[model samples]
Target chain A: MERPARTESPTIGELGESRTLARILPRLASGDAALLGAGDDAAVVAAADGRYVVTTDLLVHGPDFRLAWSTPFELGWKAAATNLTDVAAMGARPTALVVAIAAPPTTPAAVLEGIADGLHEGLAALAPGAGVVGGDLSASTVLTIAVTAFGDLEGRAPVLRSGARVGDVLAHAGARGDAARGLALLFAEGTDAAGEPDPERAAEVRARHPELVAAQLAPHPPVAAGVAAARAGATSMLDVSDGLARDARRIAEASGVGLDFDGEALGADLRVAFAGAEDHGLLATFPPGVEPPAPFEVVGRIVPAPGEVLIDGRGIDAEGWDPYSGWDGRSG
Target chain B: MERPARTESPTIGELGESRTLARILPRLASGDAALLGAGDDAAVVAAADGRYVVTTDLLVHGPDFRLAWSTPFELGWKAAATNLTDVAAMGARPTALVVAIAAPPTTPAAVLEGIADGLHEGLAALAPGAGVVGGDLSASTVLTIAVTAFGDLEGRAPVLRSGARVGDVLAHAGARGDAARGLALLFAEGTDAAGEPDPERAAEVRARHPELVAAQLAPHPPVAAGVAAARAGATSMLDVSDGLARDARRIAEASGVGLDFDGEALGADLRVAFAGAEDHGLLATFPPGVEPPAPFEVVGRIVPAPGEVLIDGRGIDAEGWDPYSGWDGRSG
Candidate 1:
């Protein structure tokens, strides 16, 4: 598959990056709840009234990303964003983030600095610079990034993927399929006369749509939108890391209901976005009567069903990428 | 370094380990905060104030452990326990965990299952049956486990390593020096006169100091003790992932104070349990007038200094294990 055209490449100093984090953290630190901000064994987040939400995710270079296609900064941002969004989807406001990375000893310190820069940048946007609390670094054969996000629910009900009810309104926030389009562009540019990918496509995509390419490389998950969904009475919510139909099916399975899509409503938008994968938007379900906040778009509906996904009122052969399954360039 | 001897080399899943975790988690699912406990994209822990605590750690088999001496279950438990303790050390109550493991493909699934069992066993003691939420399994050259922990603070102040004062009393909870001792035993056995470990000495240690060996294989962090320290108004706190002197120096540096240890108080304990690695315990400090909590032994006092550590009345060596720093087995 061709990736959409675009790329974001930025670099920083490895030795200075850790020092920068130490320097910048205290300046960005605030709120009484964060007793310990950073530079500690573990950050202490306030959970007044007892209990907190936690989640973790891992990003492997060969499996989850490729440096040839994505920049170090983008990879760092995506790693943090994906895990941060998981905490957000739980209706918990993100409080802290811990990241661990393993890279080859020969990896440039500048690349690591770029990664740290991306992490800080992402944290600045989604968490107001207060979320990233701790991290670790090590040497390995390939790059591996792992992140854990912590959140607080503020005494409200935690909306869950299993809570969608029949007649619930399915909606989405943030960009839909820009990442997939970027990928498509990459493939198309490189494809041989037989319409198969060639080496040149990657370079073309990098030159073409850097922003969209960045979308594939590093997704800016709709963190605020998730909090908005919770405030708007969303019954169930999740981040769209995988493609729409596939992730929606997860909600259906968890809620013990079927989800029906108004393919007409999403067709043009999804098509334009080139929704193949990598756009980590927030997919949420609210009660039938409540309207989603300003940023959300109605994409589907929830219903009691036979437990399966449908596309344009019929089943589609594709869903999304599976890490364990064999790849043939058909899905993602 | 060499590992200790073993009479009965139990495989990964000889006992009913996988089913044990599967069976225990449901029983602890009654808490409302865990709206989406286990079996989901991420576990949802409802925070009272919309904040949570998070932390992560990665352990590579050759670098972090050796299967020659430790059991499969012990590796699993230690891997999860280390991360859980990181979260707990912040004075937060743990709620959920995610584990990712990369192992050789030829490795039996049963061993993987045993690892899960060990993880469950570790969590069971601290979390009262809270479940493993999410994980990734893959094939790699050596076994690598990444575990992340989440927690709830219940709105109380989080005890950080930076809060100690000159007038504070230093105390510790849980066993120390045991894991280091086990390491010593393992090395002695492995480097016996013949390239193999001495079976009789290994058996002697196992019978007389099982807890010490277990500490090396599967550390049991005193999670409740951390929470208790928080409630008791601990000024500073941290889990002893590194050696006591090394970790305490971090607190001293962060707190801008000197730390003085009572060599007499530690001499007996260190001599009995010291193995030189993997002692997972909580070292905390309290105000001068505060009464020490039960199960916590007073070991040192805080002094005025800029990031200095001392034993008895003199400055002692501050060297500890560094993953990237090559090992020479020379005493500080």
Candidate 2:
């Protein structure tokens, strides 16, 4: 079926803020985190262990995603997944989320409702008990989603990036070169004659490269593995947001140690696995004798030289991954 | 000294994301709330007694504020204040904030730094010990700020808008219709010939009405009054963001009661006091025999009628506020 023009659907402005909220709020109430959720001035969530981990992330139109290429469901799922990974990176269980979304008044109400459904489904899949506790909505020329996520430590100490020690086993999970590879394909074939991302072209690319496209649109990060790593006595950890080399460099600098990667362990596409961005993988270092839980593949070892990151005795380029030379899928 | 043109200053695009963040992050580290603050995947904050209240609010460029009228400092302060009020209304002591900011790449780095300074100062003055925990920066066409606040309930049950009882005393603190009145003044005399908000004209208006302009720009909402009201056993509470009549109607509907106002207690400008929005005031109801907090000025009483709101025995217009009739200071 052909998608109707934006004008065919009722705009948020025509329905007004109150009615729009009434339409969108119901779809977002997926399960409960604790004491309170939505329809109140503020939401009360369980901290569980006296401490809660907090993080915020923003997604803006153009720099973040193209509406023409990605549906509102994808955008919302990405937004929720983006923040949940941050919480998981802290070795905490995601407890709740509060989102602030701003869109043009002319936006279709269905778009917002679809986003809400995505948020609900994403949380249900990634962090079962976590829920959208509260949210704010407003109008802007550009569509934007700002999410603040909360997580509980469950009495475990937070794993900091500065805790990796010399001789620690460097490990990773849920990351490969796939997301960035998929992104490269999209840029190469997803645009129309005018070089603008077209829905049909994007669909064609997705059909041809299903895994790659899905990786970019919806890479399921190992959220629960974070707490497992913490339980397994992992020393340090972080979410591989930037390319491997760049993010690994962060652990090197923070831990005041060197990271020596084992080339054979880095997958078939070594450079892509090391340089691909937005994989949302868990990178950690465990004490030599502390065997990591399942799914954490050993990638390297921590070394004595402070702030040095090398793969098979050679330093990787500073701008590790160059999958899409012009657009890095971060800020424009 | 005159402010330099945006081009004269180093733009974020030129400075780069890392450099702009380095310039802004330092100003945001006002004080430590607990285990972690910024510079990590997520921040860990203390949620004493195992429960925390969360709320988020967004501020968009044209709908919420105009650059020509509000400096980056004022905008940031307003953003922080806006979310802080929501938390306070929950009868919680704000403990931390996580913000997501999006702006054009061409924006001056100084503007972001100033906003960071404002976020720090606003927190210091309004909710001490509440520091920015984590944040995200992205590029967008319209400048936007989204703030999510965390508050501790301090072992007290949360105050809800639906707890009002018949014959309860309706009291308010901080709100007085001044912000809307000042906004009306700005629209009337502070814009240039093009009807666009202009700096010099806004400055002139501010100079002429210092109190009114300050009310609009930096409303010192009695943040502590909320906790005090909660401690005093207030039955219901809310922050008056949408004017008295409308918000009272919300409380009335939620509590299944009516609100009857006392004109004499409403203040010198009764209509303005009742009709103004963005006052960020604490509006609460006390049980019939319970004494209210000191700062909570009695404004009216709760009655038996369901969802009816009146002032001096007459129903107020549904559009309680007419100040800046064309601009509601909400969504565009």
Q: Model 2, B138-240: lDDT tens per residue? A: 8877789988888999999999999999999999988588998888888788887867788898999999998888788777888888889989998899988
CAPRI verdict on model 1? Answer: acceptable
DockQ of each: 0.28, 0.56
Q: Best TM-score goes to which candidate?
A: 2
CA lDDT for candidate 1:
0.67
Interface RMSD of each: 5.7, 4.0
What docking tier does model 2 reach? medium
Residue-level error in angstroms, candidate 1, position B14? 21
Candidate 1 structure quality by residue, lDDT tens digits, A1-332: 12232233221123323443453344333334566556666665566645566677667655466666666677767877887787778777776666776655445555665666677677777766445666676545556777776666766677788888888888888877887877767656645576544446666777778777767777777887777889899999987777876777788887887777777878776544323666778888999899999688887787767455554556543367444331222211
Error of 1 at A232 (Å): 3.9
Per candidate, chain B TM-score? 0.83, 0.93
Which lDDT tens digits does candidate 2 get at residues A79-157? 8887898899889999888888888777898888878877887888899988888888887877889898888899999
Go through the candidates in order and give each one's C-alpha lDDT.
0.67, 0.82
DockQ of the two-chain complex in candidate 1: 0.28
